[model samples]
Target: MTFTQNRLSSERLAQVSAGSRFSYNRTQQAIGIVHFGIGAFHRAHQAWYTDRAMDAGDRNWATCGVSLRSKNVADQLTPQDGLYTVAERSERGTHLCVVGAVQEVLVHPRDCNAIIERLSSPDTHIASFTVTEKGYCRSADGSLDPDRAGAGSIYDYLTRGLALRKERGLSGLTLLSCDNLADNGRQLERLLKAYCAENDAQLGEWIATNCTFPCTMVDRIVPATTDADRTDIMEILQVQDEAAVVTESFTQWVIEDKFAGPRPAWEQVGAEIVSDVAPYETAKLRMLNGAHSALAYLGLKAGYTFVHEAIGDPALRSLVEQLMREEAAPTVATADGQSLPSYAEALIARFANPALQHKLIQIGMDGSQKIPQRWLETLEANRTAGRQCPAIIAAMKAWFAHLRGDNGPVEDPMADRLTEIASRTSDAQCAVALFGEGGMMPRIWQVSEEKLQALFS
Candidate 1:
């Protein structure tokens, strides 16, 4: 494979075609949003939206991304001068667009002080996060874990930044969470307030009086970019972009219409700013994410490599459809004028997109962090309503089987603990050991031995 030595940068923009490059003047843009977890999802979703908003003449919302841990993203984007490609893939074809929404990428701790400065700046009105569920460092019950929420964590940085903002007499910032967590923005506020109260009461009080954390529902299927994706994108752009992200054509962002200060004209660029985001978020978390997780473990176990392949299989397709329509959808309170049936059908079609090679194992990673909201919430709801979710039960069993190495090595954060429990306990006892009294799950989420045995049977 011959490599494209010409890297994607601002200078190379002149060589690229008109429609593919950013129409807005990149040099004139100001960074108003500092985002955490600068991964493929963020680049493909939020940054892409911001890029579109810029194209529509909103110049101040360009993002300054911070990678909390690895500098891999920084290494990818820094050399490219924060320029990257977003390839929107679908059954039709791939549409490539160069996104210049990110002005800079910073790595935490090393660029810690700079990050805080960026966060505290008056220009930075929104501090957004896409740090996955585990990044919050919450315990099973969802409270902030003191050990994990210390220095170098997102909470610590925000507290320090907010403190500095207060000292500088700048207005409060909006803490926007774009993760899949239910009530993500509010959860962020609660966790941050807890952290601040424990460390600095004054800061906590100020945050309570000033800042706003609005719930948001972000949807996009951005698979991890493979070598083929990079090569394909490079072929299109005629310049190598290591930071290019390939995703499905469908994208949605529903944010609660609450902000501490001015924000981008995101609504103009297809973002939904509503009074309440609960119904939408719940539907998404339960139906889309729950089905994704189920498909991941189940598909991997069934020897399917990509989502399209698994979704193509009639049995797997039926299972996913049942999981979404019967088990997950019933738990969601439909938003005003929102059709759950249509949404579920659209999700099915999205999963079957042949152009996007979404890996099952990629979605299966961090199952411990994902399932509590994805599957467990739906399961708990059904259980409380005296309705059994057989599909969810099957998925749960599949997850357990996955943990036991039936689907190869587990990639969960609690891999050691989970694998230990799965190995030591019998099939009937596995559910009890994992979800029983004093188990990994919360006390309220206890499972019976009979249920496990029935599932096995």
Candidate 2:
């Protein structure tokens, strides 16, 4: 069948492999989740888990995805009847499954009332988010920026939705944050409350009294879906799935056990429901994400395009291992029975997975917003302990070089300012200029001139 004529949909489910088709009745499942920032990561990770739960007989937890800015995802999934494929690729092979957990996709502002109506429904038990760090519109101090909390922001939509729920006398929902932020749930609660407090004090009181924000630590390596991925998915499913996502087989989600309402049996599908997600989040952020950023900048500088290729280089591989082990690992206080060494080694193996084709450039984007949590915190923690981090320093140098367009164009929130700083300042003084007082980063590094020269050399 041709691409246009054989689009994947409810009617076309029988055409795909039996195992890839939804095991449960998709039509009978109700939408219990209103997810913001329905991007590739959300699809390949959270929605995949939700699909697994549904397959295991947990219904009424299907997701309604909200695209805050773009209509691209809505355009892709709506045409396919919200049935998209997730191709889990690895060195072994590819495993394709059609995720039916996302029942609908709504573009915000245009469908704002529909979204609010969904949120106010008693059946909707959760409002989750995968909006990247910048989507929070946080100031440097990590508080919500009131100026950016205008109409059409997630904060605006959520506040309005929650208020409607309150007015409708519906039970409060759990606001789950699946992003890579530190103490994600608490941070989300704090920011949302701040927004509510400023705009509607009564709504803030209602939220404080009723809603729950459960912190989550979500880990997955989902690369941006390319045309090649779409073609491969088409071959496997025998139907066109434009919204198909490609990811590594490995996935982990650690959630704080607190929730305002009933939720899916995500634990049965391998999600960890724990009291504290801090240790897990810190470990993943420092080890996996820090190593990833290092690989991206260093790998690009070394002329490597993909993660597996970069880790295949001995020097880069050793550097990443040391960054995770010697630098990042020490700062992470692991949970009981959690092994940092094993996690780091697993990350290396995952990065070396040839079939995933995770791009260096994709990881490298938004470095200015990402580096603080991924690398700088590790650096600061090591500094506080009086331990040296040559590996992190090397990575930082690579990042600084990256800012100067050593590899290619910078794709960061602070791109223009950072590039300008890199252009005007000397190598020895650049770090100071960027991390010093009035700089982007929180803490300044105190590296000597000799070491700085050695870095460039």
TM-score of every prediction relative to native: 0.97, 0.96
Residues 294-344, candidate 2, lDDT per residue (tens digit)?
999889989999999999999999999999999999998889999998998
By TM-score, the best candidate is: 1
| 1-457: candidate 1 lDDT, tens digit per residue | 4546689998888877888978988888788999999999999999999999889988788899999989999999998999999999987888999999999999977999999999998889999999999899988778999999998899989999999999999999989999999889888988998998789999999998899999999999999999999999888878898999999889999999999999999999899999999999999999999999989888887889999999999998999999889888888887779999999999999999989999999999988888888877887888888877877777788888888988788887689999999877765577777666666865544457566566555
Clashes of 2: 0
Clashes of 1: 0
Considering summed lDDT, which 10 consecutive residues are worst modelled in model 1? 441-450
RMSD of each: 1.5, 2.1
Note the Cα lDDT for every prediction shown.
0.89, 0.87
Give the CA lDDT, 0 to 100, for residue 248 in model 1: 88
